[model samples]
Target: MAQELNQLEDASIVKELQRRLNEKSASLLEMEQMTRRLLSLNEQIRHTETIKSEFISLIKTEFRTPISSLLQESQQLVENIGNTDVVATGSHLHQQLLRIDFHMKNIFAAAELEAGETRNAYVKVRLESLIEDALAILQYVVKQKQLRIESTIDLPEGTLVTDAGKMQLVLMNLLSNACEYSYGGDTIRIRGTVEGDRILVSVEDPGEGIPEEHLEHIFQKFYQYHSGKTRLQKGLGLGLNVARGLVDLLGGSVHCTSAPGGKSTVFTVSLPLKDDREVKDTSDGGNDFMFEAF
Candidate 1:
């Protein structure tokens, strides 16, 4: 009887040891999982910080040009108050204001997109009007560069149901990029067409085209292609990304193709034809005034 009891006690001790070992194994697994998660979070935080730094640098670079121009123009106007050609100085100031507004809008839109707060308000809008508005806004830039814009609108004057505001932003970015990269006297061609159930718009420039490898990553946020010791152009590198995002929100696709030897490039946007039945009512007045031409 004594031996049996002793054997039972030994068995109890072994079971308790097994239980403790199982608990320890589970605890170790949980700890490993927690550690992996923490590492992943840390990596994400680092990436976010890197992106924030790059974006801030780009913003400063982009703002410098326009702000300097504004300051110089203002000083000239003040110095020559009566002697300066009022019309010319006023026009210059107007252009500078437009440039500042354009950049500010893009920056705001990019922030909204990053925060995932941007929403599309679809309305029946003429594509031509949007294109014209964008061109008008960038007219000063084009004149400054001695660039010519050749536009061919193949679609009928029929209004398309879409987010006119966002679409305007998209077209502006494309046209702005074209003008920014093209050399003096270069012609930037814009063409719009209706293909099947989609509206296709293309902005082509005879500038230094993007490289094959860089083309794929051009639409990524904060992505800029560095060429040798300098960058291909001066920008916040948010235009294409914001444009792509707006296009996607409108249920469209954007793509690019470049000619060999970086001689030319084309950015195309394809958007679905609006179905009237699916249109949403956004009648409540909002910030449409912000996008209006000054």
Candidate 2:
């Protein structure tokens, strides 16, 4: 009787062990299948990302050259329209073309900057002349907006080695911001000076001051400070970000200041000057032009 009971106990133990082993094996198989599925999904995601990147590159290569050509043609059209006798409609068409060309160039520049292809080639430029040129470009736009844009520049007429075109764009971006944020009959002031080895330019607008919370992120890409949906304040929110990037490319720094109830905001840029010889450009072998009368 004792031997039979011991045999029964051994059999039951063996059955229990086999049952636990079977359960563990099934769990291991399920876990393996899940891991394999996860890895396959990860590979698919990587493949999709690769395809998107290639598509963007292809689009850029196919579109960049034609866009450049269109911009050039539009510029020529503007010049021709100015010189030739044209009706009001022709003049309006020319202006519209110029506006489209400007937007296209901005898009191109932004793409170049994003692709890490922005080149900084500096040359000796008359600082005052550059400012005057930028101001002239904005004069018509400001007038259309019915905004008063004024500049107070108190700097020695001097030359600086910088990317003149980029500088002009920087000024235009800031001026555009001022105009875009201001109401009709609003006052916008642009002021600058040569302080030490740097030239500082500032644009102040008395429209709506940026809130404190937004100030920290104002330079971020695609950031708009206002919540009101008004025509006066609309953009891709790219101007300031691109301006900051361009300024940094030129070895300069841009900053902003704002206060609550101040009802105005200021953007300031400080750029270093190059050497003195480049400042005083001698056109011929004759005497060097005075450096203080740029």
Candidate 3:
């Protein structure tokens, strides 16, 4: 009877040891899963932080130009309030304000695009008028650079059924890029024509053309070609990307070609011709009259 009881106690001890071993194994497995989850969360946090940093840098650089222009013009207007040329000063201030407005719109549009909102409100607009309006807004930059603009328009019926605001943005970016890169005495050519069911607009500049390798990537967001330690131009590298995005939303295509030795570059945007019968009013009814400065 004593031997049998001793054997039963030994069996109980072995069972308890097995139970404790199983519990330890489960705990280790749980810990491993938790560690993996923590690692994944850390990686996600790092990615979010990186994107936030980049966005802040982009806004700072893009806003600098317009804000500086506004401050300078405002100060000038205040100083010349009592002068006979106050009218001219006010005009300059108005232009600067327009510049600020343009940049603000770009920032909002970019954010929308990033959020997968590419739909635009279409309207019947004249391509010539849009081009002229863009040129007028860029007149200060043209005068500052002493650059001459030569424009030729040959559209079918001189009308386009599209988003006038988006088209203006596209034209502004292309023209601004041309003006910024070209020499003081250089000539920038803008030509628009209609062929079949498509309209083609080209902006050409005799500036330091893009390298062959960089041409294809120029439309990428935040992509800027670095030729040396110092950049050949100053920009937030968002213009081309925004232009491409707007053009794509309009069911259009944009292409770039450069001369050998980076001597000249031309950007062309092709859009579908608007059919009057299929046109519908898509204006937001907001007074964008400020954009029609011309």
Candidate 1: list runs displaced more than 4 Å: 1-51, 226-233, 278-283, 286-294
Candidate 1 TM-score, true structure as reference: 0.77
Cα misplacement distance, residue 166 of candidate 1 (Å): 0.4
Those runs of model 2 whose alpha carbons end farther than 4 Å from true positions after fitting are 1-87, 229-233, 276-294
Worst window of 10 by summed lDDT in candidate 2: 285-294
The whole-model lDDT of each prediction reads 0.82, 0.68, 0.77
User: lDDT-based ranking, best first?
Assistant: 1, 3, 2
In Å, residue 153's CA in model 3 sits off its true spot by 0.8
Scored by TM-score, the top model is 1
For every candidate, C-alpha RMSD to the true structure in Å:
4.7, 9.2, 6.7
Model 3 weakest lDDT span, ten residues long: 285-294
- What is the overall TM-score of model 2 with all chains considered together? 0.62
Which residue pairs show backbone clashes in model 1?
209-262
lDDT of 1 by residue, 1-294 (tens): 999999999999999999999999999999999999999999999999998998888778777877898888888888887774867987888877887788888888887777787666677777778888898888787887888888898877554777878889999999988888777788999998889999999999998778888988999987876553212346777789999988988899999999745478899999998777756675575324235322
Candidate 2 lDDT over residue span 176-212, tens digit each: 7777777678888988788888988899988767778
Give per-candidate clash totals.
Answer: 1, 1, 0
